[model samples]
Target chain A: MDTEQQVMDHFEATCRSHGLKLTHQRLEIYRALLQSAEHPSAESLHKQLETRLPTLSLDTVYRTLATFEQLGLVKRVETMSSQARFEAKIEQHHHFFCDQCRQLIDFTWHSFDSMGLPEALMGVGTIRGKNVVVHGVCNDCLEKKKKPE
Target chain B: MDTEQQVMDHFEATCRSHGLKLTHQRLEIYRALLQSAEHPSAESLHKQLETRLPTLSLDTVYRTLATFEQLGLVKRVETMSSQARFEAKIEQHHHFFCDQCRQLIDFTWHSFDSMGLPEALMGVGTIRGKNVVVHGVCNDCLEKKKKPE
Candidate 1:
């Protein structure tokens, strides 16, 4: 994973190569995505940036994130929810999503990393990346359920 | 995996158990999802069902799918794309998504199926399901890229 500054620099270089202007909104949106560990959606990002960027609209945030996605500078985290979540960490990792708490936690699986693609997927595609999302009730939620009201 | 008829019967049972009316629209939407392997979005489903149900609206499709999701009658296939995709097959399986062609293929990994949850996730949550999505350029797209147009 790149350092925060390195990620920002790469973002700028990628924008230059794509002939896209490094607008304030775009930079802020990318920064917000980079800084957040929660894999926030556009609406959440817009809300976070509202005080700092009072004039920033949610539509602009959505469009900027879409452009970043097109440039391969960011990734959209897969979720069962209707809203799309964005992340700037383009690293090899998996997610553990708590269905009860709605928390998305990232964890790396070395065994999976070492294991090659499954035999079943041999001819399916030119494999780029694999992501696993494990959905369950988090420990805290389970504890809460255990305790009687 | 349940047979198509079995899946539909289960849907009816679930709706009835939840006290949701087994309305024509809901039944048709669930039927379309059951029949489709594409994991279509609400918009695509609405377009597919429009010919059969002239009065059905996209909003209804979206709402019905949401209700079905809340009721655990359908599973939303996670995708990087903004549009949410729905699938009625709740069995243990995985997906291979082609970024270029936008094709979502389902494949079962017995090894993954047999292997218990990774050691890292032991305390993170009470695991219910693990879904793997592999993203890549499909074979056809790679062939197209190789051939000079």
Candidate 2:
């Protein structure tokens, strides 16, 4: 089976075991999230799905995504923007965000997992996950600055 | 001179150098940010300043924050909530975010700076700053879970 099919099957089994109904709309939303590697907000996901599923409401999309989040099916990414964006937990990775344009780019590094976590933090509580965000100006914005026109 | 005073002076000098007006309202907004270790949103800041700056409007607070951010006088922290929050660049540090209640707590660790960044990200663009977030259930929430109401 291909990666997408495998992902779908995993979501299906997880949902079934948790007694979550994999309705058509829920599945479509999950598919959209899996396909959106850029990490999409609820409104953006709604816009992308509107053409394909004309009758889909933004609220339903939000509710479904919220459910998925509750079940650990997705991870919400941090952005300077007011909108909360989300990404699928396909694997462990870190994000590079452009402070100028608020663009979030993700990439993985094996070294991060092996880094010694501070004992100070460990004593505070149980850590579920860790994320690092490298912030700077993206190439597009840097180029735009170089050329006024 | 104390650190806060030095920070305020730096902000004033930066504003002057950039030809940005440091009006009374702007200064108050900056003051609020400097005092807020919790990193408050514009509305929260406005509410906090209501007594001393009774005439200040929410829109004006928002506008001032936008100007301060544009001037590099402040940094916006990413929270799970849709309300965008701002923090004064008092110093470099990381955050501990409560996954249960969405509380963001700041703490610093020097080891993160020594970790080598992945070259794949270096190829993407220029990186100026980095922040790490440790996600977990806070002590309060953990206790609540242990005793169950």
Top lDDT model:
1
Highest TM-score scorer: 2
Error of 2 at B84 (Å): 1.2
Q: Per-candidate DockQ versus the true complex?
A: 0.70, 0.70
Model 2 achieves a DockQ score of 0.70
CAPRI class of candidate 1: medium
For A1-149, candidate 2 gives per-residue lDDT tens digits of 25888889999998999998879898999999988877889999999999889999999988988899888888777777778888776578888988787888888877886777775686667788888888898898899999979
TM-score of chain B of each: 0.89, 0.87
Which pairs of residues clash in candidate 2, taking residues 3 or more apart in a chain or in different chains?
none
- Candidates in order, TM-scores: namely 0.81, 0.88
Candidate 1 accuracy as lDDT: 0.87
| Tens-digit lDDT track of model 1 for B91-134 | 77899999898889999888877767778887996888888888
